[model samples]
Target: MSRTIISSNVRSYFASLWTATLYHAIRQSNWIAIAVTGVFSLILFIAAEVSPTEGTWGISKASWLSVCGGVFASFLFLCIQSMLSALKATNRDMYKAAFNELVEKHGIKTVFSQRGSDDVITLYRKLLSSPRRRIWAIGMTNKHFVDQHLESLVHVLTSYQIDLVIAFWDPSTTLIVRQNGGRARSIIEAQSALEGNPGSKWGETIRQRQLRIANAVKDQPIRGDVRIVNVSSVTSFSCFIIDDDLFFFPFLANTDSTNDPTIYCAAEGSVGRSIIDHFTKLLQNSEVCTTTYHQKETTVVVPMT
Candidate 1:
């Protein structure tokens, strides 16, 4: 009775261990390794069990079994490693596809070169040629951009109603200190460095330029609103959304917006829709001032709560 009890206990321990091990292996989805291991194990067992009455091909059963056993062990180890590699690769592919699936499908064009196939100015000209599209532009109200892409800008401004968001963060409080420490001088310093006596000339010059552009948009034959938003906290990415088409580029800490690589896509697609939604949210949350020029000039200042 004692011996039987001890035998049963030993069998139960092994049964549980085998069950756990098999469960873990299957759960890992190591099917190839498991299949190969089972087949090799069966072959090894057969070779060991067969007793050679006579030599076949001048090799004894003992030698045959020894060679087969070593080969089986090697193969089992290789299969397990292969299975791990396969799993890792599968996981990596999934994440890579999720993040860059749009880039792969739509293709990312670099606008680094002005004369290349990926030139942004050329692309802008091509995209903005559609007269039916509503244009939404968000960036620093830099006139240099307008001058460089004059033809495209003219087409867009004249073609349809243009919704423009100009950045209005205080230079002294925000960009001058945070982003352009040495490269940018304070208003006081710049005034003092002037050819004449120090005054509010620098500030006036900036205000005048901003007003000039706002007035230009207001005077256009097509109707649109020029809005000012504080984007110091949100982002420095410049975006140009032409109807369903969108082109965006990020401003690096020490680089120009024009030099940055622009990403373009149709706003109706998943990625584009998400981008459009985000833009709309930003607009909703940040309307510091708006000037409309449809029938007549109308300026509305949204008081910050």
Candidate 2:
């Protein structure tokens, strides 16, 4: 084998040996094997002092014993440090292996608690750098996504032709909105004490959410067409698909979707595929959203029938 291969093999062997030694040291009780060597060295010191021999093999007995004991202690100290360093390195490798395993099993890439954070934005910008053919976003209103990502989308639109679809829960008609103790308008007293405020914002239904989409993309993109799929109740999570990456997260009842943990998955993978399939079926059964906007086109409003 070449020198490089031989070096690699040797390194691997030492790494394994060091790791094994560390584990063995951890498993051993206080009566460790190294302590026996220390005891033997102590006995040698006593022998050196007790013996009357001035020298052996032209070396003073006491000095020889002292040198031997010093060498033994130095070697032991080096072994301990090497093993500790090895243990530290192996732990890091174990963490990487575990992370890879999770990614393989669930198609889960990055998982962070806050959505639309700097990390999410950075990831999107990087993804936009690649050649993208299609982009689909799914969520409850998806207002947060549009607010943070529309700038990058505009920039990419100038560069390449991409098919963009924004799928959101119909704010006015979705039953998935917080029922807030399951109290329906008909059941609750119109002027009861329970009605502390006359407003509900689990979703902002004040203006058609499609208006936000329309306005965000109204500035005609020379390349991309933005479409909307307004579904009612299949809104399990907020999802954004840009090419092969699917970004998604849950909707916390009391807080914004941004407060939930967002998950990244490969668009071709199982988790992403299942989500896409559900939306596809919903789109097939879709009605034209209340407010429709495609880049550079006149905004069209469809009355709920």
Candidate 3:
């Protein structure tokens, strides 16, 4: 450990030991304090009884002196005990302040053990069910999210004029979506130690989903004009904002987001707002493409031979 840390720890340890052992060693008793004070008081009483002193109202001088000395010693002990109690309270407040600062620094409210777990999905459903004016996403194709939460999304988006935006990685420039500074692996290099799947193999084009959303918007009471856009920058995380809730997922090597941890925070928090700002910039800088379905897609089936 660093010198400062070790010194602080050592200081804290002694302070605690002093508070506990000298004052509160026994839960229901103060034997040590009583004994130490008793001995000191006895010495004071003895010294005062031997001192030469005057008497008041016919009281013996030695008797009055000893009495005053004993009372003074008792009061001193009481003050010391009170000081220790106050010290403990101060320490507790300091610790609480430190914890609050840590929480503020990260702006994290909850850390879901696993992303896409039952509780996480349930929370998403609940958040979507609420009345909202818009929804935003930053992720890959977002097919997985749509396919998985289609019902909830449709229900919520249709409940009100909650617009949706899906800003996904542009597949053309996403040939290598590794972490920043990650060395590029050859396409021929098979994914082995890691399920190092190439970017192209994932996130299907949003062309079709856009049409579905368009159709819903045309007929549904709610505005479901899902704007699908492409982002050229590489990302190591996916963020989704539902109402005031922000869900952040940092990708792990070869692991699907569903298996990774999820950080949930309020949109107003420092972490959440910063991420939303970045996503807003991504959409603004990239030309957002809005697709309108001219007509229902038709298919001609060949006669079976």
Candidate 4:
């Protein structure tokens, strides 16, 4: 009972001390006070560094000062430049300017509102799911639209030889195990470790997803091939070319898919052709993915004997 009472008293004292300190801190907090304190602190720091005691440091005083001064000057310059840029043109203004430039250059016409996923889905179906379909697409390593909304449409493309330029990552060992089967994941992780980058498992699940699609393509009744090229780069946009129609989906950072804008361009237009050409360039730089395969089975019936 005595020990418990003492412990309670000790806690109460500390709580009171904290409360007093917080009260004083809040009372003293002011812009003028802060500025004055900062200036004095800077001055004291400078004096202490320059008026150093006799010490045999590796770097000479002059050389160290010169290097520190240079770093400070560079940092100051960058801060000033950033402030000027922000003042001159805000991020919103820059985005508007870029949008206007693109619109003017491409003579773009907004077909549908760039608002929701449904809008994009409607446009995709109208363009890609026609009786006669001709399409080429460039998208993220693991494209959600393709995986989620367009699964049924995917089987149709199995009859046509499609080209894919995917931005794939090196997946981590844990992720590989979670996604792929245990046996396959163990082998993959062991092989990856042997290559001297055990922790380099950036995009294993995405690669596996793409491989699944590739294998599915190979299984179609009409033999169709999807040539996958894996590139190591971050993509800010996804492009799909259906016949002469082009759809562009901008990747919005820190936003859900429902908020991201999907743009549609006519194939005969200059903007559409330019977008297609850009996708072609991306395709040219990617490394071919030759991991997935489809094994054909044969069945023979014996004559009545």
Which candidate leads in lDDT?
2
Candidate 1 pairs with clashing backbones = none
Error of 2 at 120 (Å): 2.8
lDDT of 4 by residue, 1-305 (tens): 99999999999866755555444434443434444545554554474476666322565556555655665565555545544444344444545665776665564657454535676767776665552545555554445645653465455554444432333332322223544464344323343454443543446555666667555544455323344444333445666666666777765542343455667777666777777776666556534322223222211111111
Pairs in steric clash, model 2: none
Tell how far residue 32 is off in model 1, in angstroms: 6.4
Pairs in steric clash, model 4: 170-201, 170-202, 171-201, 171-202, 172-201, 244-267
lDDT of 2 by residue, 1-305 (tens): 69999999999878876776577556545335556666766776776777778876688987878776795786588557656765676677666667776677557787877777889878877886754687787766566667777777766666778877777665445222254565454211121113343345534442456665565555544565667655555345667788889888875543344566788898676787897787667766746343344452333333222
**Candidate 3 residue-wise lDDT, 227-302, digit = tens:** 6565665556788888778898876665454678899987777787898888877777735322223211121121
Whole-model lDDT, candidate 2? 0.63
Task: List the pairs of residues colliding in candidate 3.
Answer: none
What's the TM-score of every candidate structure? Answer: 0.49, 0.60, 0.61, 0.44
- Model 1 poorest ten-residue lDDT run: 288-297
The best-first sequence of candidates by TM-score reads 3, 2, 1, 4
Off by over 4 Å in 4: 1-107, 111-116, 131-133, 158-202, 286-305
* Candidate 4, position 32, lDDT: 41
Clashes of each: 0, 0, 0, 6
Off by more than 4 A, model 1: 1-46, 49-59, 66-92, 95-97, 100-118, 157-237, 247-287, 290-305
Q: Against the hidden true structure, what lDDT does model 3 obtain?
A: 0.62
Q: Pick the candidate with the highest TM-score.
A: 3
